[model samples]
Target: MKTLRKYLSAEGLIKSIYSKFKKIQDPKNRTGKISLTDCLMSCFAIFSLKGLLQAEE
Candidate 1:
């Protein structure tokens, strides 16, 4: 249980999660100003914020 608590914390997992996001393949035909990893991370951030907001209610 103690081990689970340590790794499961959002602070601890963020870097690992972001690294995984960077590995995803980009399907865009041409490279744009923004990178695919950034886009995915942005969506992840939005979803995380939404979850936090719902938890507060």
Candidate 2:
């Protein structure tokens, strides 16, 4: 079974980000299909990919 232990790896960093994002309260007046955390993580993923692409150039 997989454990919930935090590690000093990339997976640990992602888990940390997700946990922190969950603490942020949603501010939208109307509810959307996606959750706030999912939106924030999507943005983060985009930026991360952009950085990687730039570094490859």
Pick the lDDT winner: 2
- Measured by TM-score, how close is model 1 to the native structure? 0.62
What are the lDDT scores of the predictions, listed in order? 0.75, 0.81
List, residue by residue over 1-57, the lDDT tens digit for candidate 2. 876548776678888999999999987744878899999888777677677557657
Which regions of candidate 2 deviate over 4 angstroms?
A: 1-7, 50-57
**Deviation from native of the Cα of residue 15 in model 2, angstroms:** 0.5
Model 2 poorest 10 in a row by lDDT: 48-57
Residue 28 shift from truth in candidate 1, angstroms:
1.9
* Candidate 1, position 4, lDDT: 45
